[model samples]
Target chain A: MAGENMVGTVAIIGAGIGGIYLAAELGVAGFKLRLHDIDDARLADVRAFGGIDVEGERGGFAAVELATSDLRAAVDGADAIIIVTGGNAQAAVARSLALLLRDGQIILLVQGNTGGSLIVRRALDAAGCHADVAVAEMDNYPYSCRRLAPARIRPIVAKRWLQIAAFPGNRIAAVHQRLSPLFPQAVAAPNALYTGFTNANAMLHVANCVANAARIESGDIYKFYAEGVTPAVARLYEAINAERVAVAAALGASVPSLEEWFDRVYGVREASLVETCQRLTYNSDGPYQATGTPSSLEHKFITEDVPTGLIPMVALGAAAGVPTPAIDALVAIVRNMTGRDFAAEGRTLARLGLSGTGVAEIIRVMNEGFA
Target chain B: MAGENMVGTVAIIGAGIGGIYLAAELGVAGFKLRLHDIDDARLADVRAFGGIDVEGERGGFAAVELATSDLRAAVDGADAIIIVTGGNAQAAVARSLALLLRDGQIILLVQGNTGGSLIVRRALDAAGCHADVAVAEMDNYPYSCRRLAPARIRPIVAKRWLQIAAFPGNRIAAVHQRLSPLFPQAVAAPNALYTGFTNANAMLHVANCVANAARIESGDIYKFYAEGVTPAVARLYEAINAERVAVAAALGASVPSLEEWFDRVYGVREASLVETCQRLTYNSDGPYQATGTPSSLEHKFITEDVPTGLIPMVALGAAAGVPTPAIDALVAIVRNMTGRDFAAEGRTLARLGLSGTGVAEIIRVMNEGFA
Candidate 1:
């Protein structure tokens, strides 16, 4: 109950799957919750059911103190605000919250795709919000969830471990202390740099998606990890993963190799990456198995992962003097396939307000505000 | 006809589909033909049958003047030497013929995949051969034929037109005059540079193969041109094709685009590349439809095309100062997937003995031999 008193009143932005599940779990844990979403029909559905009926892995008829579309009312006096919107909408949410956030409020991104917190921090500064707020981000969402209805959430699986870090990184300990009660499996990372580099979706999705683009477009129904990731495709995954590891090391963060990460998370240790992915197909109970193959090249696997995931890694690699030919090649192929310029639209060092900064200075800026 | 006295004797090298097809067509046309193949079993099969049974498009039972494994005996006193071994075996065939070849003999490569003539000429020099010889190449093989058995050949579909050019631009008309009696559809180009730039396999195979790699590895049985070239994949094809066109333009060679080439060759006038490929599947008679999907990553679609096809184009691109990001990206992905250094192993200016030469000089060398 370390955070029971400190994080008493919490606001959950985005009434999507992650937000709804968080509302039900926090409500059943005896904490006050307010939920907000821009979609009026969604809010209406939630109001009709009174609150979320949390199911799967945890059971409860949890109630929320308030449900509205108003940003100000949702975070008026809340001690913490958790954003569950995907990376595509994170910046806009941060911009909208710039004028409404209060002092001592904490904002945690459920999953900070590479440099998520840095993006929000920049957006808040651009909007001229002077609130003394701490921004934290997790490496990935802690739950694989679905909204059965607007007011019903089924958390398929809760991850065994989660990595969380705060902007400037100096306030990670205090932030971790307050968020531990909400996510018992959460562990403190040195900074958002570590959490951002720990993003697995970037390394796993784009190459496999592009490699299987025709299979997806032709409406082939097959297991994404088991069948889509062939031996050669798996080798490509390893090649890109090596570039990601080198970028993280150049930025003073040491993360596990993709194999080690898969071993730790899915517990599928095999001789090669292809075998590991095949074993993950049948072994990792529900998370990867439930992941549907993208029907088109426009799926989040490429549209979201390429710009937000691979683009940022390429930018960071350029900043740290690490050559990322494999990553750059993936980005180029995606751009050619989609006819979109992901590099220009992606989150680069300039977007993160760290353009032209050296490795040491970039690390310092990541741990300390630009001011 | 006209070439009956000018080209009375022909030497057909290799016992593969192309070589066997060439032997039957020439023998039936009333020319003496000598067939050579290193494989004794293949030559034995030919001797057992006493000739080639040409089936499909052209039907005939034709006899050869001599069938031998010895290189010297095959080309001795022959007016024309046609090398039908694929691009992979062309250099060795050229080296073996260097000392054995007589003065004023013409050597025609059925399908000189990018820079085929240059490779053969270089191999000839390295072997210390001093002989008066004229080297020529064709844009592509003339027929989509297969060997039904050791001595049985099926010419599925013969191309409507064939482009041929000699090593030195001054000798193309003479070479075309002597070869026209055997191939009435033959057209003369400026030099090997023009014929080499017209190679279509390099522009078609590698990108589509890489895009549909997973399907190929998973043993998916689908029409390669129709099912494999989806909309997104077709866009990638166009992107890489543009680089090839630009490289040709930089070298002062005006070539038709991939779409236009298909229109001229297949008579399929579709709006987009995807539709053209789809139409080609059903409308191109038997060539594209009969093309099977690759069964493995090691198939010649990649192993041969990437090295002999795209690699040479990439090297030419660098010499011409054209940026081939899309082509380079495809090369990088294939290299990463297969863990092979295609750039170093492929045809380059250095391999052609034209390193540091400008676009104009490279073109000059392609037209005029080093002498």
Candidate 2:
């Protein structure tokens, strides 16, 4: 493989909360690291965080010295590329990377929201790259971090078991072996479908936030992980989980229950889901604080999550004959409120170039794990 | 016609705004009147207002003797009963009236919400007194008055048209003949179904109030008839109108558009619907102020209107395969907020003793008129 010597070098795109923490973690673990973000302000903030130190205790750190404006230049000689850009920015960044990335480079999406890996793959193909790059996804970043300022990141929790999978199911083990030393929580998920369906943040956050729009709009600063999970809210959480499960089943992915996934991610034993969320938020060293941007559920819950995440699940649920009334009502309400038909938005099956396949065929392809 | 001797005497139940103004209007016109209410204090208030005097001009003078009671005494020995009890008090008053009402007496329900005529009819049947009583309904009382205190009613707008009908269509002309002299614009509706379906207040108020619950809770109050009729709010109004039309179609009833109904009811040649509502509220010489209750929409909109009025329309819409997404979502959200399954609590075809009938059968029964 060309650039085999660059195996330990890592490139992280988009220095957002997720990208910054991962770069900090991996850089401190002795990996040669390069951090890049489109926002100049965000890039400056990362530079203010003492630059990525790559020669430290976790594995023998390598300082993160390289930062770039050009996406292609950022991933030119890197062994692994970790993408943490916004969902809107994903395709463009992927296109740029595909144009310059060489063979055998690993492109790992920290959170493959709305089939970001597939989108990236399509963009790469469009850019005419023939390299056999390993494209994979990790469902979501395995840590909870918040940008306290333009520069400072305060991580709340480092997840212990993060389910990761390569594009094709057969190559997951190989990817895990390479990433295992860096992510102690790394586990080979059944396929990309498993990762896609197991996105609890999107599932839980969307419903809770949307339903409580009144409370949120009134400037009731909600500790989302703490006070947000009341009994009624927990029922909403379960409903969302049910939708995710239905989608996973329809896609032939072996997904764990929300509670089980919670345990795996938090490394907590015998903790109820609500209690776990509460404990995380109420913790003294936790990232949650009294002030932040208005967590308008309209955007995160209805606009992004419902259309990009929940609608797909709902479609799959309908295909599988799983009645998801709560999810359906939510989708309808959001549609009414926003005056938009989310079902026709981007990443839908029709938009994804896979409109004709039946549920069974879709499941087979998802299980086989191709972009 | 054994009760023809007593036919000229009008019994008004509930000495609230509607009851008192209706009694005053009929009484001043030389009809013997008896006013009844559960609240003794409210009865004293009506008595203090000089009963009813209908001598000079429109809003000139009125004085009439009234006997008030809990329920039993209200319906006893009366020729025609006009029910103006609180929405929540309807079932109880209906039950009591069934026990005391004599054969051939007329029971007219103002604000004939969600099968109000049927509710009273069923109660009479249950009481084993299925006599030759004419159960009739009016779209609403002809005046709007407010109980400013225990004994003071501030008159608002007296309606121009008072559409009256009997439950079985046959008695509509006879019923209209008896009631028309008191209302200059009195007209015979097709049947009780038409009267029930033309309740514009219920249709417009419920959806807007429930959808804007957050704003209401935040203490934002606006003249519901005026400022609340903005474009966004009007969309909800249109949705409700559509549902009402669907219900009317299901029952084979002729339903008028809101604009047409407003023009007919208000007797204004060029006044828009919103303008009529505004004038009804602000016009001092109008009867609406004198007979209308508090401007709060919660009781009429949420409690009575939703379950009694809207749900029936929803059920009919379901039977007719017409989509009422806006209504459905509003009902669901209100039910969630209030912790009630309004559908089960609401009036339905089965509740009205027409469960298994086709539209033709219902039409035939309505045409035959109630005895």
Scored by lDDT, the top model is 1
Q: Which candidate should be chosen as best, given DockQ against the real structure?
A: 1
Question: How closely does chain A match the true chain A in each prediction, as TM-score?
Answer: 0.93, 0.87
lDDT of 2 by residue, A1-371 (tens): 22343358788998876787787677666777788877666777456555643221242222567766667767878888988875556778878776688888888888876566666777888889789888888877776655455544455567777788777656777777777776877788867778878776566665555444444544555566555555445555766676678767766777878788766776543356567666656766443333242444445445656765777666666666677666676666556545567777746665444566677766665556434
**After superposition, candidate 1 runs with Cα above 4 Å error:** A1-5, A16-33, A42-47, A51-67, A145-156, A284-286, B1-5, B17-34, B42-47, B51-58, B62-68, B146-156, B284-286
Model 2 chain A weakest lDDT span, ten residues long: A53-62
For model 1, give the RMSD to the true fold: 2.6
lDDT of 2 by residue, B183-219 (tens): 6676898777788888866677665554344344334
Taking all chains together, each candidate's TM-score versus the true structure is: 0.94, 0.74
| Angstrom error at residue B357, model 2 | 4.6
**lDDT: worst 10-residue window of model 2 chain B:** B288-297
- Give the Å shift of residue B161 in candidate 1: 3.0
Worst ten-residue run, lDDT, model 1 chain B? Answer: B1-10
Q: Candidate 1, residues A110-187: lDDT per residue as tens digits? A: 888888899999899889889989999998877665567667776666677778999978889889988888888889
